[model samples]
Each structure stands twice: as C-alpha cells, then as structure tokens.
Target: MEIFELDKEQWKDFKLHFKWSSDKYYKVDIRKTQTGLMVELKLQTTDKPIVKDYEEPLWQQWMDEESDDEAQIFGVKIDSEIVGWMTVGMESWNNRLRVYELLVLEGYRRRGIGKLLLDKAKQIARQKNCRAIILETQTNNVNAIEFYKKQGFEFDGLDITAYHNDDVERNEVRIEMVCRNF
Candidate 1:
C-alpha cells in the first residue's frame, strides 16, 4: 500500500461508496439546566441490524461550500488503484486539523487501510502543528463510531440539529469526534 498526496483532479475521479448496515445505534441522552447541558451517549444493538445506505446530498452541499483548494487529500493506492482516501485541512480559528473525509472502498474495509489513512492524517496534523484531528459523523454510523474510537478518537460534542430541522428525529444527528495531538 502506498499513501501519497493527490491533486484535486485526481480526487475528482475518485468515487466513494459508503454503505453500512447496523443492528445498533448510539442513543443520546441530554440534560439541560440553567447553567449548562450534559449529554450521555450509549450504543443500543437489536436482534436485527438496521441497514441504511447514506445518500450524500447534504455532504455534497457542504463540500460545495467548503474550499477544496485548501484541503490536503491523501489516497491509498493498492496495485495502482485507489482503495482508501482521507482529507484534512487546518482550522485556523481553532488551530486544529479538521478531517473532511476518511473513506475506504467496501472491498478494502477492515484491512488496515483506514488506519493507514488515519495515521497519515495524524502525521500531517503534527507537521502542521495542529492541536487535534476533528471530524463529524452521524449517530447511526455505529461501525464508523467504533472505528473512530479504535483510532483514539473521543466524542467531543454533538449537534442535534446540524443537518436539518428534524435531525435527531430522523436519526441523523451529527456527532463530533476528536483525536488530540497534544
């Protein structure tokens, strides 16, 4: 496996297919008071896994708004084919590295490709003097959550209404995860 920086043109041809079927999801419990808010998160798996294939309309819109020119994208090439990819950019305000995307092809899953990409992202973050590597994911993506946790990421926060008016109801609540460099 070879990991290297890829240009935007190369990224344009790269296709990402995210498919997940989980019998479980992270259930969030929120407590709010006059002072602040407290949240408790836990995973609940059922007898049957609920399967959902994420459509990327919202993500596409977000990508449209965000500048890709400033992003540093790395691709994992296996036998000259891109099997995994990750993108990281500096968040100037927070002095952190925001992971825009980290994906491996379905056939490449659970083969350490994602870890390689994550490791590369960390290396880049250190080189850029960032404090942490941050990314947002949906609560329904239990597999991804486990992967993030295995990669040393912890739940930072969550936005109950990040994508739409009924985000939590729709089970698409956005949860932020962070892997601190310092």
Candidate 2:
C-alpha cells in the first residue's frame, strides 16, 4: 500500500465507510473530592454486540463544510484505489492537531493503514510545532480505543453529552484521546 496526500481528483470517488460492532464499553464515573473532580473509566461488557454506523456518510458533508485549504487529508491507495483515509487539521488557537476522521475499508483493516495515517498526522503536527494530536472516539468503540492506546494516546477527557440527547442511554459517550509526545 502507498500513502500519499489526497489529490482533488481522487477525493470524490472514495466512499467513506466506518461500521463497527462491539460488546464492550467504557463506563464513566464522576466523583467530587475536596481537592478536585475525579473521573474514572471502567470497562464494561455486554452479552450482545452494540453496533454503530453513520446515519448518512460524512464525506460529502465534510467536503461541503471544510475547505480543502483548511484540512489536510491523507489517503492509502492500493493499485490506484483508496482503501483508507485520514483527515487532520491544525488548531492554531489550541496549538494542536485535531484528527477529524480516520477510517480504513473493512477489508483493509488490521494492516497498519490506520497507524500509517496517524504517523502522517503526527509528522504534520510536528512540522507545525503543535503540542499534541487529539481525536475523539466513542466509548463503545473498544477496538479503536485499544488501537489508540497502542499508538501512545491516553484518555484526555470525556463528553457525556457529545452526541444525541440519549448518548448516555445509547452507551455512546464521546471519549477524547491525546498523544502529547511525537
């Protein structure tokens, strides 16, 4: 597989697909102590699998809203076909790189494409003198969580209401992960 900066002509043909199912989720517990607030993460498992998918693909919407000048997208190509892609942007105000999207085709997963994308993001961030690389993943995405951890990311924060009104009920809390060192 070859990794390259996404070309304009190659962007439209690549379909974005990120579908996942997991039986494990991180449960959040917040407590208040005299010094400060403490947040705990517990791994919880379910007998049945929990599936997650976009209501509609996000590529078109992202293309519409995010200008090419603002976001840098890297694509993994195999025989001229894009099998994986990652989008990242430098948040100047925060002095960090924000990873907006990272996805590999279902068949292309577990082959280091995601890691290559992340490595590209880190390289870009270092060039820009950013402090960290940040991204968000759902609590139910255990695979992604594990992968991020293996990639040297740590749990930075949590948003209990990041998604819909029933995010907590749906077991889809948004968990923020960050890699501070290159």
Candidate 3:
C-alpha cells in the first residue's frame, strides 16, 4: 500500500463513506454540584449492536473560507484503489494539531492502515511544533475510542450537546481525545 498526500482537487473528488457497528457505548451523566458540576461517563453494553453509516465530503460546509486553517489530507491506496485516509489541520490558537477525519474502508481495516495515517498525523504535529493532537469521536463509537486509546490518546473532554439536545440520552455524545506526548 502507498500513502500519499492529496491535493485540493483530489480531495474535492474524494468521498469518504463507511459503516461501523458497536456493541457498547459510553453513557454520560452530568449533575450540578455545590461549587461546579460533576460529569460522569460510564461504559455500557447495548442489548443490540448499534450501526452507523456516514458519507461526507472532505470540506465541511461549516468551514470558514477566509480562515487560515487549511487541512492536509493523506490517503492509502492499494492497487490504485483508495482504502484509507486522514485529514489534519493546525489550530493556531490552541497550538495543537486537529485530526479532522480518519477513515478506513471496511474490508481494509485491521491491516495497520489507520495507524499509518495516524503516524503521518503525528509527523505533521512534530513538524508544526504542536502541543498535542486532538480529535473527536462519538460515544457510541466504542471501537474508535479504543483504537485512539491504544494510540496513546486519553479522554480530554466531551460535548453533551454536539449532535443534539439529547445526545447523551441518544448514546451519541461527542468525546474529545487528545494525545499530548506526540
């Protein structure tokens, strides 16, 4: 497999679509405290597997056109077919590198493609003098969370309302994972 950087035009033409299933998810609970608030995330096993299918473009509609944030996209191709990709960008204000997206096709998973993409992200972070590498994933994405954890990332924060007002109840809370050492 060959991993190469994708130009803007190539990125525009690339479409990332994948499906993932999980039998466990994190249950989020927030409560008001005397001084502040207490937030708890508990791992829970679901009665049935939860599956999510997504299709998205490299450039999101919410991205600012005039902003200095420019994403660097990389892809892994096998036999001239794209099987995995990652998108990373520098967050100047936070002095950190943000992984916008990381996806590996279903049949191509478990072959270290994701790790290669992540290693490339780490390389970029080192070159940019980034303080850390951060990325977001849903609470229901247990596999992804485990993968990130194995890659030296820890839970940094979470957004209970990222997807909807009842994201926590829906088992889709947004979790922010960070790798500070690399």
Candidate 4:
C-alpha cells in the first residue's frame, strides 16, 4: 500500500464510505453542583453491537465557501484502489491542526492505515508550527476513541449537545480528543 497526497480534483471524486461496529460506548452523565456542573463519562456495554455505515463526499458543499480553514487530503491506495484517507486542516485562528476527517475501509482497518494517516497529520502540524492536533468522535465510537488514545490523544473536552439536544441521551455525545505533544 502507498500513501500520497490527493489533489482537489481527486479528492472531489473521492467518496468516504465505511462501516464500524462497537460493543461498548461511553455514557455521558452531567449534574449540577454548587460550584458548577460536573461531567462524567462511564464506559458501558451495549446489549448488541452498535453498527454504523456512512457514505458521503470528501468535502461538504456547504463548507466550500464559508470555511476559512485551509486543508489537505491524503489517501492510502493499494493497486489503484483507495482504501483510506484523511483530511487535515489548519485553523489559523487557533494555530492548531484539526483532523476534519479520517476513514479507513473496513477491510483495510487494523493494518496501520489509520495510524499512517494520523502520523501524516502530525507531521503537517509540526511543519506548520501548530499548537496541537485535535479531532472529534462520537462517544459511541469506542473503537475510534481507543485508537486515538493509543496514538497519544487524550479527552480534551466534550459537547453534550453537539449533534442534538438529546445527544447525551442518545449515547452519541461529541468527544473532542487532542494530542498536544504533536
């Protein structure tokens, strides 16, 4: 397998599609305290494996004009077939590199493809003098969370209502992970 940078045209034609299954998720719990609010995330097991499938264009059309973030796309290809890719962007306002997206095909997972892509993102961050590398994943995506943790990321913060008002109830709270050492 070979990893390389993808041009705009090539990225435009690239579609990110992947499926994931998880038997565990982080349960978000929030409570009001005298001083402030208290937040907790507990690892919980699901009765059955939660599966998710997604298929979408590399870049959202709405983000084209409104987004001021500068990004680059890199893909992993094997024998002319693209199996995984990552979109890393520079947030000038924050002076950090954000991983906008990262996906590896189901069959290509566990082969260091995701790590390779993330390593590339770190390299870019260092080259650009970024303060850190940050990305988001759902609490229900335990596998992804574990992967990020293994790569030296820690839970920096979380949004209880990022996707919807009942995101916590839905067990899909948005988790912001950061690798500051990068």
* lDDT value, candidate 1, whole model: 0.78
Alpha-carbon RMSD, candidate 2 = 2.7
| Reference-based TM-score of each model | 0.85, 0.87, 0.93, 0.93
- Write down the lDDT of every candidate, Cα atoms only: 0.78, 0.82, 0.87, 0.86
Scored against the true structure, residue 160 in model 2 reaches a CA lDDT of 85
The regions of model 3 sitting more than 4 angstroms off are: 61-69
Q: For model 1, state the Cα shift of residue 131 in Å.
A: 0.8
lDDT of 4 by residue, 29-137 (tens): 9999999998999999999998988886776544334334546788899899988988777777788788878999888889999999999989988998889999999
lDDT of 3 at 149: 94
Q: How many clashing residue pairs, candidate 2? A: 0
Q: How high is the lDDT of residue 34 in model 3?
A: 97
Model 3 lDDT per residue over 1-182, tens place: 88999886646756789699999999999999999999989999999999999887765533323124677778999998989988788888889888888999999998999999999988888988989999999999999999999898999999888889999789999999999987
Q: Which TM-score value belongs to model 3?
A: 0.93
Question: What ranking of all candidate models by TM-score puts the best one first?
Answer: 3, 4, 2, 1
Local error of candidate 1 at residue 124 (angstroms):
0.7
Q: Tens digits of per-residue lDDT for model 1 on 14-90?
A: 55566778777887777897899877777777677767665331123244345333777788999979888777777
Question: Candidate 3 at 126: error in angstroms?
Answer: 0.4
**Which 10 consecutive positions of candidate 2 have the poorest summed lDDT?**
55-64
